[model samples]
Target: MSSTSSTVLRAEHIWLDGKLMKWDEGNVHVMTHALHYGLGVFEGIRAYKTHDGRLAVFRLREHIRRLLDSAHIIMLQIPYSEDELVEATVDLLRKQKQQFANGAYLRPVAFMGDGAMGLGAVNPTRVGITAWDWGAYLGDKGIKEGIRAKVSSFTRNHVNVNMVRGKITGQYVNSILAKREAVLAGYDEAILLDISGFVAEASGENIFLVNKKGVIKTPPLSSPVLDGITRDTVLKLLRDAGHTTIEEVTVTRDALYIANEVFFTGTAAEITPVREVDNRQIGDGKPGPISKYVQDTYFRVVRGQEARYADWLTYV
Candidate 1:
């Protein structure tokens, strides 16, 4: 496999359940309850190489807290404690430190294992953690030149149908459909709207709009959007830096077209600018100044250069 491929497929060990096992042994039966019913919750976390040459994960505890929240939302009980999972994640990162020198993406998933079938399927929860090197999710070029996004036909799931607060495994099927549609339509990513027609978020990232007045606006948590950890970090950072960040804003599709700037936030996408949406150019068709500021600041904080946020990092 190419060195830069996301799927390395060769890891020393995988933290499964409560023990580390060979990557080849990280197996699940075809009839696993989660596999059949999609009763799993997962988190995407990243560890970065600090300026001082140490490796640390950003917002590690916060991510774990969210993971637990996701699990609670689905009534799945993880077999391990948060402290144990955090320790396992740090240990896993240390074990793969050599291959993931460029930094790594950690996927920690908790799901229902093999057990009862049908509507009454009840099973013990299984947890697994995998670490691998990952570069910018939207590609370096997409980060620099900005990405093209299409408003998807797929509507965000109704809160009554799917709990928007939890990162349920099956909930991503909608994202998959929307993303595939956008990619096939020749766009970089897809933007989903709420059932009521107001703007929601991108396929795998949270959306942000910068109005001409220079205020930053994003869809509220009530808008059926995932409460993205990265989104929270950015808002906190902006507020700390004396910038106005607004939430619970109802942004229409046409509002995006005339916005001064637009961007997406998530652990994977970070802070990527949206240069155009539906062929409407955004602010000279480039990464806007505010977007650049947030991106640079985020990188610095993640890399341990910003001491004010140093407590956010967990060293491996």
Candidate 2:
């Protein structure tokens, strides 16, 4: 991580209305309608600097599609098409002179165009793509370090009320509050429960547990959890790599105390091992084997080692 190495790796490459801006220099309006109200859709996409020096984005099409789908759900009409998002990403990478030998991270956001708010001011949606050098979202706190997570006292917004499937701006208020509560409670993060008292997600990431039989289980999207792109990828990776995974509807507070192991996933956090849930140790209190497998295989797929998932990447 030398200064030159840092410069060579993970420099700011962001897009604003087809124009490239320095990551720090990127700006938006203070009065933007979406800023005031969660009226826009966004995606957290990742690209890695591969061993071959190729910068490959993981699940480009799928992530953009999700962003577009989110936009459509909110009735926001982005001026660009799916192809345009992909093209803008490519052109931005080339202009930034990004090193293709390694993969990098990517983010694309589509929001209502700048204006004061009226409830129905979404006919003109503005879209932008931004990317930078980002590492695992587990933060500087490693999974082995074992962070604590508090079960949020505040419940997540119901799908009936907030349309939880879409990645809207306001949806994160629940996340922010839960995270803040965890920090105040002297824990690393928070786990949010859906309205029905089922475990929906751990703050921004999805949750998984190992049953007494050593089977992997995760909550289905039928719960309040937004369909995470990484969660989807891991489900495919585990199954393809020959592991049995189950989607269970069970969400008892007791389930946390009886699990062999538990972990969380997201674009930012990647595969994070949860050693403790609510102060209870998870399976002798260490990152589990299955969690490690998911982490190892996921980075491989993102880095383009797994040809089976290569379609998920866009090599630049």
Candidate 3:
């Protein structure tokens, strides 16, 4: 079977509500409130294979906490507790044999269920957790050789327009539209601008720029970007490696064309270098030295090679 098809077939079961069942058995009604109104919250998490031949979930508690926070922001009352969800994730990972062998992606979602039909209709919330072996969010080639991006014409949603802090299901429509635009325009990804034309982020990843001074800079949380867990990990790793990391730095679109190197961070994207933006080559048109350093360090940390960050891993 093709690799993509094989990956899709790998997950035989999923954790629904509080029980493990056949993947096909997990279903939702057609009139699900969240489906109609986009009133749901979710989290994207990954488990990794450590160098010592052990399976571990990176930053499990933090991801679970964020999931709870997102649900709270959207007024979706998750029936299960944080500890319950964490245990469910571990249990689900343990049940999936492929995950134990090669790591996997875990998705935990809680949304309003089918009940009332209006905008103000109150309904019970439903939860589900599923996982499957998956590869890089951007193509693997992009990870090794770097990717090309364009400044998207679409502006990111202002904070007032949506709760930027929450991973609301509906908020991703903006990203979807921008990603489609980038793909149609022959770019690997899109760099969205905040309402004010300041650098925000890629469709699903956080953007970072490294200048000649060897300093790392990314948009502040106040910008129209998700406060990514991987973004936090990268900044911490950079500073721990003796590089200065700056946040909330306003980066103009023109600044990207002149950056020594540009990269993106997220649970899926990891650390992907941007070789070009809007036809402008960053530095020498290769992954910058600082980008490589951070990417290398991040890979090691996630794989349990970095002893100092061992606490970040939760073994299965």
Candidate 4:
């Protein structure tokens, strides 16, 4: 196994195929079925360094449950129960305390191993869990000062064509294309529209817009958006903060242009405000009051400052 580097930090150990292994030794066969067919499901979870100096994973159980649900959706049965997987994640983190001293990002994935080589192939299932220190995915500046986004020429997957509810590994090709297009075109992020021209979501994040009327709106599950955990947390936070006008409704692209504020949410992006869409400045081209409030509150809740949301944290 190779030693860690400044640009690339490897966990001391990783959980693979039901056991812990050295990080460099956790390799799969070259002909792994999922590598060719993209038949897999996964989840992105985060652990936070609490205010009192403890490490806690945010919504760990919920993320594990969703991973199982995604596997079920694609008919790929994971070998372990949700509780077992959760324990494995905790154990993995425990073994990497120094590496993940500040916080960590966990990826739990289940996929098909090498076997038959066709679309209808049935192969053995393999599960792996990896954790590593990570920072703001969209860049720290993007999270604080807000980011610029463009409505991608690529459309979101139609409901029947791809399973929108499942975080399937193969299904993210659409997101990759959109994200690359945006980056190549000099934009920070991409916003994809649904088939019917309704605003869907960012490449890998759920979107929320605050309109001129102080109403917060996001695309419903009926739309082609993912059921993002961070999106759910933000909704709950908004309601608990006594904002009564939160609504899950169909939104058009033009609505984003006219919105007083826009933002993206996900395990990776967290609460990232969108300062501009296609060169049009959003609310004076700065993070709006509501966006900043939600971002601040989210960080606090994740880091264990909000006692009311303690149930959402699982200590490592």
**Largest lDDT belongs to which candidate?**
4
Per-model clash counts, in order, read: 0, 16, 0, 0
Off by over 4 Å in 1: 1-10, 245-247
Error of 2 at 262 (Å): 0.7
Ranking by lDDT: 4, 1, 3, 2
lDDT of 3: 0.87
What lDDT score belongs to each candidate, Candidate 1 first?
A: 0.89, 0.76, 0.87, 0.92
RMSD of candidate 4 to true structure, Å: 3.1
The order by descending TM-score is 4, 1, 3, 2
What TM-score does prediction 4 earn? 0.97
* Candidate 1 per-residue C-alpha lDDT over 1-316 given as tens digits, one digit per residue, 9 for 90 to 100: 1111255545688899888888889999998988888999999999998999889999999899989999999899988888999999998888878776668889999999997888687788999999866777877888888999999999998889979999889999999899888888888889999989999899999999898888789998888899999999999988999985565588999999999999999998888999999999998899999899989999999999999998999998
RMSD of 3: 2.2
Residues 170-215, model 2: lDDT tens digits: 7888888888778787777789888878888887898888878887
What's the residue-level lDDT of 116 in candidate 1? 84
Question: Clashing residue pairs in candidate 4, if any?
Answer: none
For model 2, the run of ten residues with the poorest summed lDDT: 1-10
Cα-lDDT of candidate 4? 0.92
In model 4, which range of ten residues has the least summed lDDT?
1-10
Write out the backbone clash pairs for model 1.
none
lDDT of 3 at 78: 93
